[model samples]
Target: MSVVDPGSTRGRIVAAGIELLGTEGARALTHRRVDERAGLPQGSTSNHFRSRAALLGGVIDGLVAGELREAEAVHPATAEELVEQLAALVELLTGPMRVTTAARHVLFLEAAHDPALRDRLSRDRRAYVASVVAVLEQLDAADPPAAAEALMALCEGIILHRVARHDETDPRPAIAVAVRGALSAPGDG
Candidate 1:
């Protein structure tokens, strides 16, 4: 029999974990389920990721990478232009990106209980904040780091609100309001 590469098995397991995170949320994420979804032996998932937290860490990293890629798609030439970019990001969060962000929340809550997990979460979050700051800086926004931190908080808050209410109200207006507040001139600060 031809030997299947271990790397392929690892990829499949990670893919399965991502799908589970999106569809069933964190509770349904497990080695057995990931193994079954990936059509691999039950042991394969454990072999690749020794612990549940390890697997979750991988999923979080993947999700962050995906978000960074999506964020990159919205470019702004000026602080005013960044408002539109921020709106675009909010729309993306309120729509297709909802699963990723929502699932990330679940993972984040889980991380809170585990110091190792919390460290991973904090590092990934800082990276994301830095990416946002870089984008805002490119648009000549004053206090890009602070602006990015505020924007991330706004996005998370909007996601929580939308998820809890399940209401049809779009989050764009609220996000725009927050962004405008963040991007207000230094004199206003």
Candidate 2:
């Protein structure tokens, strides 16, 4: 078998962690599993990540980057159009991107007792909110600052609702409806 380069092993481990986080979730994420999935020596995972919390931080970073990329890629024409864009985003998030959200929730829970993990998660969340704000500004040519805050609030609400429900059913439809309503309502400002 071909040997994986030491330089690339760190990235491979992170990628493998992301994949595992997406598929098997936080509980399934282990250093051994990451090393095995990346076809690296057992020490590779420990050498790079050092701790499970750090590895989880890397995975969450990847998820945040993906979310920002998706949000940045879409530019809608009007407020209604923006709501539609959010709907599509929610659908993708609750569908293909569900694992990312799931992992995020798991990380949040784990962070309760882990200060390092909590800090990493808080920073990641702030970045995500900023990205969402940027997208909201682009979508609504007027008063984007306010819209961004409202949008972020809406997103948080949706996440909380979904977490509370624990995937008994898809939360996208309800979240989309709530977002659309909020976007149309003026009181949110």
Candidate 3:
């Protein structure tokens, strides 16, 4: 991950938003909370983001940027490689990146009443799904798009479960099974 500039007021506010989302969920996502978490003067967060939707947009941007930065290069042609990929991803989804996973879910729930958040998520969702499709194609799946959707859904399920439980141990084995099942015999699962 890139180093966040602490001196950047906007970055600090966004980081605070992520922290709040992770630790306190959507209810604590107000600008006042972000200002307190960021150690900024009252209303400073509003000065930067203007509104809750805009603040949520910053959090989405932060998460999406991190995702792009940490994305692995996929070149899987065998079950082993695909399983390994899934294993690493499961580690991230269930381990050190749990905060990000949680924050994303918070944003997802908040998106139901926030059009801007919904739009932002929709844009990122398309790119993320497309990335999965490309990887499935590289794996030479018979139906790359279908397999991608299944894998994406399976991945989301894993993230949601891990975030809900806050489990420490790696859940890679279970994730591997699901991914292999999804990628097996193209459209089979």
Candidate 4:
């Protein structure tokens, strides 16, 4: 849960790693490349992260910390407000935070083949879902955990479509429908 100081050398290295992954893909995520991207002296990244696995772990940590910070800024009082916030979040992810989002997607693909990375992602994902479940409970959802999972899946799908397909469609309407559905009881449909 500790935040990495962006001004610190470690932070710079992690940021550089994200940028490299997003722009140049996984193959370019070498220590030398990260050092060059961060404008640090050669071997600086290696000094901080002894291996590529360690470096990837650091990047995942940095990404989760930053995304959690952003998510914390959004406080929704009701289901409707949550819909708006979620839509805004989608825009933010695919717009201003595009590179970071892309970097996350890259890590997600990498995690599919790496057990340690997948475990890290799953842990973070559970923490994030728990926070959403708390919000849903406060909003009077019949099944807060399930509702939160659905909402998260909806947002992730929208973000993936927008980011991977270059789709410019407005995501609000779909978000509204999903949010309302999640908040509704089984027989209320």
lDDT of 2: 0.67
- Quote the RMSD, in angstroms, for model 2: 5.3
Clashes of 1: 0
Give a tens-digit lDDT track for model 3, residues 150-188: 777776777787679765556567657766666678456
Question: Which regions of candidate 1 deviate over 4 angstroms?
Answer: 1-7
Residue 166 accuracy (lDDT) in model 4: 89
Against the true structure, whose lDDT is highest? 4
Task: Return the TM-score for each candidate structure.
Answer: 0.83, 0.72, 0.83, 0.97
Q: Is candidate 2 or candidate 4 better by lDDT?
A: 4
Question: Counting only residues 3 or more apart in sequence or on different chains, how many pairs clash (N, Cα, C under 3 Å) in candidate 2?
Answer: 0
Candidate 1 per-residue C-alpha lDDT over 1-189 given as tens digits, one digit per residue, 9 for 90 to 100: 122233588767776787788668888899999999889987999997899977887677667767777777767776556666766776676577777767777777877787887888788777778778877777666688888888888777766776656655665676667667666778874
Could you give candidate 2's per-residue lDDT for residues 1-189 as a string of tens digits? 123333487768867886787677677899999999889988888887888867776676666767767777666665556666766776567667776766666677778988888887777667666766666565543555565666766765665565445444454465556545545546644
lDDT of each: 0.74, 0.67, 0.76, 0.89
- Tally clashes: model 4: 0
Name model 4 segments beyond 4 Å from true. Answer: none
lDDT score at residue 137, model 1, on the 0-100 scale: 74
